[model samples]
Target: MRSLVLEDFGRLTLHHEEEPHPPAGCVAVAVAYSGICGTDIHGYTGSNGRRRSGQVMGHEASGVVLSTAADVVGVSIGDRVVINPLVGCGACGACLRGQAQQCPDQSVIGVTPSSPGAYADVVIVPAGNLVALPAALSLRLAALVEPLAVAVHAIELGRPQRGEVVAVLGGGPIGQSVVLALSVLEPQARVLISEPNADRRRLCTDLGALPFDPGSTGAGAPTDLVIDAVGHPATYAAALSTTRRGSRTVVIGLHSQQVTIDAFALTTGERSLHGSYCYTPTDLRRAVDVLTTRPQQAATLVSTVVSPEESAATFDWLASPAPPAGKVLICFTDTNEPVAAHR
Candidate 1:
């Protein structure tokens, strides 16, 4: 098995190692395409404390099943699927409510060093983490299901109504996915994306969203709903400043560990603020459903695809001042064909 291992902080090296065999209650997936998330870039650059040296860092992924252990009944060989990655103890209340991120015992496959992620030819995951993809969705597009699930979960939390003034702070993968999700759920809402980068703002506009550059101009009119995809202190303040007296604010970004927020902002406005992490089981299903039903908007999220050998340069470029406007995928397999059917 060829795997891209993080040799150290700010370094990624591809190594040829023996393939891992799935133990009981697990399955091995032949990874097709894995998306490099902003979190992955931060981890690669050693900004976020989550990623460690010599770890295989990947979570957003899609592939075909290679083999399943004896006890794994639902997943099987040749099944095209997207990995959920988040795992929690089944007996916990959070897990019972399908909110694994809140579980104290939760650990993600790619983020946690103990479990290797999808940055290789094959990855081993528990049987329950695999979410089967539809026959119509291509494997490349299926790689986006994980991030899109995050967007879907945030949207559900915000519960923004139609014709409401909706604003998203960052126009990256999650923000783009939020725009697409809103297009489906709240088409009548006036969606505005605040991004400084020209390319990213244009891409948001292309997705039928209005662009508001906060770099040149101050935060726009106060909105009814604000989805802050950039989790910095400034964006946090902007989220509060831009919301009316009574509004909904959903935070989906993991950029910063902490933000200094004023108590008066929430009290003065009577605003409801919620922190959204990973998706629920229902949100994951909705993400896959949206991907299957709306192929065009979902397909536009992918910007580039490269092979495993290009891992180092790709990670470096992604961490640089200017990354691609859309999602950058690393393909582990030779055949990047669409999964037309899976029995």
Candidate 2:
């Protein structure tokens, strides 16, 4: 088995390792495609701080089930599935409340140090964490279910209604997914996305979102719902200020910068603010349905696909300023299958 190991900050090395066996109640997956998440970029740049040296980092992936433990029932061998990387202790208070992503003992596959990620030929995960992909969904597109679930959860928090104006801050992979999710969940609602990058803005526009340049214009006059997908101090401020009175704002971006907001406006306006983490199993299922029903809309977000050999360079490029827009997928198997693309 081959895995991409983070040697240190800003460095990734390809290493060979023994194939992993499935543990009790777990399944071993032969990873076919893995998407490089923004969190992976942050890990590469040492911005997230959770990722450490020699860690195998990737979470968004799809693969074929190689083997399943004796205790595993729902999943079977040779089944195609998407990996939900967030694993929570079922006995935790958060888990009891159906908020497993908030579990104190939660361990994410790619982000956590102890668990190896899908950036390898094979990755093992709890059978419960696997979402079986429909026959209509391709392996390459199945890798998107994880991030799309994140978007779905964010929208669920916002609960944007018909005719309401929704604004999304950022146009990265998650941000674009947010736009796509919003379009599907609230087709009648007007959507606006603030992204400084011209390419990203163009992509958002093509996805039926009105793109706004935050540098030139503000977040478009107090939207009914504002989703801060960028997580920068400035984006947080924008999300706070641009939210209309009694409306809601959802924060999904991961940034370390401290943010300050006007307490008077928050108290006087009766607004609600939420922080969304990874999605629950329900959200992942919804994401899969969305991908299966609207494959072309989901396909538009996949901008680039590269082989495992090119992943190191792709990570470096993503760490650089103004990297290419849209999702960057890593294809583990060398097959001539035609994958969907936007451009």
Candidate 1: 10-residue stretch with minimal lDDT: 334-343
lDDT of 1 by residue, 162-271 (tens): 78989999999899999988888778999999888888888888888898754444656778998999888888888887788999899999778878897798988899
Overall lDDT per candidate, in order of appearance: 0.87, 0.86
Sequence-dependent TM-score of model 1: 0.95
State the lDDT of candidate 2 residue by residue for 203-243, as single tens digits.
88888999765545553566899898978788877766777
Off by over 4 Å in 2: 213-221, 334-343
Q: State which candidate has the highest lDDT.
A: 1
Quote the positional error of residue 326 for candidate 2 in Å: 0.4
